[model samples]
Target: MAIPKYHELRISALRLLSDGRSMKLRDFLEPLANEFKLTDEEINEMYPSGNGHIFYDRISWALSYLNMAGLLDKPARGIYKISKKGVTMFNSETPEYINEFVDKEVAKRDKIKKNKNPEIKIIDLNDRQTPQEGLYTSFNNIRNSIYEEILTTILTKTPAAFEKLVVMLLQKMGYGGEIKNSGVVTKQSNDGGIDGIIKEDILGFGRINIQAKRYRLDIAVGREEIQRFVGALAVAQSNKGVFITTSYFSKGAIEYVENLFGNTTVVLIDGKNLASYIYDYGLGMQVEQTIEIKKMDTDFWDSMANQ
Candidate 1:
């Protein structure tokens, strides 16, 4: 069965912490998951955004809402305990009443925020997004948030780290011919803008030059940069080049690569595409869950009826 809605998750979380013990979020998740009798497959299911497991994500959101309502206390990051109010609610009423309590609390907070800023809007946090379209929109929003975090984390790493990440990704995509000597980062001179070299085959009959740019997400890679990389490829007498950046390329830059009708081939990869590759190849990310959706087989049913 599917996990409960957001408010229900809040109720479950509070009941689990009613003993007044400060529980780590990681530890609390186990019992909460067990209470629902969720299979390992169900627990591992991921959201469409591929950022996190759906079960864990919903549980985290429930904890956030409960904290906002003053029913839960966070003594430290990822560690939560039930508040006096939460204990009272647990003892006096059914978990369903927590929904009403949370609604009032959220409304009060939104009203306070609205007084300070008229532009702010308060939305109904429960049961409004039940349809498929609403579900997709919500999933996309979560995915976008995750993408922002990935870019921010990438910015904090060294340029060499980014280079190594790209190499690892290409190798996973089957670009590096063999395990040993598949690719090497040219540290000695920037090699006229080339950061690394990848061999196409084990025999080294062909090679590809790689230029990695750790540009800020807001910045755009221009045609001039691509041209310089092309010149570097020429200097090295290589016909293949890959120009990758943690930012997007301008229209002119893309057109330049498309119109360059010669032996040289330059493939451009931007920030969004880069992150997608990282996710797909599991380079820096891990599998949180795998979910499978089953559809009815009309042909099999029809055959049974005919029989």
Candidate 2:
């Protein structure tokens, strides 16, 4: 079954705490998984950031929202119990009604804070996405825009520049050891299908051949082109190759590489993936700003309380 939304988990959380038992955040995982009948895979599914399980993150957000709405009480660090308001709301309100109430309550608190501190920005909680989800969505949208810009910029550069860029990207990806001149872009003329090469070691025993294509967005690298590259690898007597393009590969091209039998291994990086790699490796890009998201240290608070 699909994981329940954070708002959907609100009533269930209240129901769990209705008996006046204090529960830790971890205590909710099994009961909530059982309540939703989530499969093992679903329970273990991770957020795109890979920091935590998506299900667990959503449950934490649900509890936080409930606390913000005065529906739950945190009597101790990392511990939660349904308050009188929460029990009353759970018994009397539908899920949708409770969600709307939470939104209104949060907005009211924001209004009160805004009256005291004009610098505090208010958020619109009407959207189904939680604040964290909204932040990630915004981040992805910005990254996609930058990816398009990177492709457009690369398409305008000369073929040699594109080859050099690919070589630099591979080096940034740790293709070569901390040795200078480990990666080299071959000359355009008299060069085989390979555009660049990276020495994987100091002794130049292992190498990764590169074939970079500065193709138009509408063009696709086809099976014939891949076969030609394989033939070129055979001539070079090298089995490892990377074919990067400012376009995509045809289905036949991908299938041909996938079904290849031998020691030869070719990795394909299309325009989208190429741009993503460039971004990830911080090639041809600089950090304009960094935002840090901070959270409460509940364990530290618990330690202080014990003292």
Candidate 3:
């Protein structure tokens, strides 16, 4: 069976502590996995960022929500026990109960904020995703929309502008040291297949050749195109090359570069990755706003209590 969503884990987690036994947060993993009959693969599935186990993360969020809603009590660090309210909730509440509680809590907090400052706005909550998850999802969505806009804007520019942009992006990424004229876009004519070059040092002892293709989104840069770029690298006597395109590469093109046996190395940057790099490196983009998410500092409170 598919792994249960974090919200779905709420009632099950409450049920686990319904017997009045205190369990460390880690202790809940095994029994919950067993109760859900989750496969080993499902239990160990990871987030896209590969930071932590997905199932374990969901479980932690479930416990946190229960604790916040006054259904669970934390008597010691990393340990949790069901409260009298939790036992009552386990017997009476349905799976959807946590969502209603969270919405009400958010409304209450917003109400308090509005009383202090009349301009305060109520926050919208997604029943299926925790706040952190929703924030990341919204961030990714905005970034993806910007990527489409970036590609469309790039396509509107001349081919020479695209070549210069690629070179500038590499320079911004610190490919070349701080040296004047370290990166240059070659003249349109008699430049061979290479469109740009980056001198890796002040003396121009090492260099990286660049080939930028401003192709339509539907176009796929094929093996022959990559071969020509490699040949251009050979002519320039440079062993490193970057083949960037506003379109994706064909399977054969990718495999050809992968299986090459020599000092020459080529890196392919496709449309999606190209846009992401531009956004990440702050190339031709500006930060319009910044939002900071803050959490309680438990250690500060612990130190104060001891003092």
Where model 2 places Cα greater than 4 Å from the true spot, the runs are 1-126, 304-307
Candidate 2 lDDT for residue 219: 99
Task: Assess the local accuracy of residue 94 in candidate 3 as a C-alpha lDDT between 0 and 100.
Answer: 67
Clashing pairs in 1: 44-289
Q: For model 2, which pairs clash?
A: none
lDDT against the true structure, per candidate, is 0.80, 0.88, 0.85
Error of 1 at 263 (Å): 0.9
Best first by lDDT, ranked = 2, 3, 1
lDDT of 1 by residue, 1-307 (tens): 7776666688878878889988876775689888988888888888666867888878887887888899998775567999998888889987667888887897787687568447443444464765654655555545544665577678878999988877777877788756577887888354578888888877776888899999998799999999999999999999999998988999999999999977999999988778767776777787755545466899888778553
Residue 295 C-alpha lDDT in model 2: 89
Q: Which stretches of candidate 3 lie over 4 Å from their true place?
A: 1-127
Query: Candidate 2: minimum summed lDDT over ten consecutive residues — where?
Result: 116-125
Ranking by TM-score: 1, 3, 2
Q: Tell me how many residue pairs clash in candidate 3.
A: 0
RMSD of each: 10.0, 20.8, 21.0
TM-score for candidate 1, please give it: 0.59
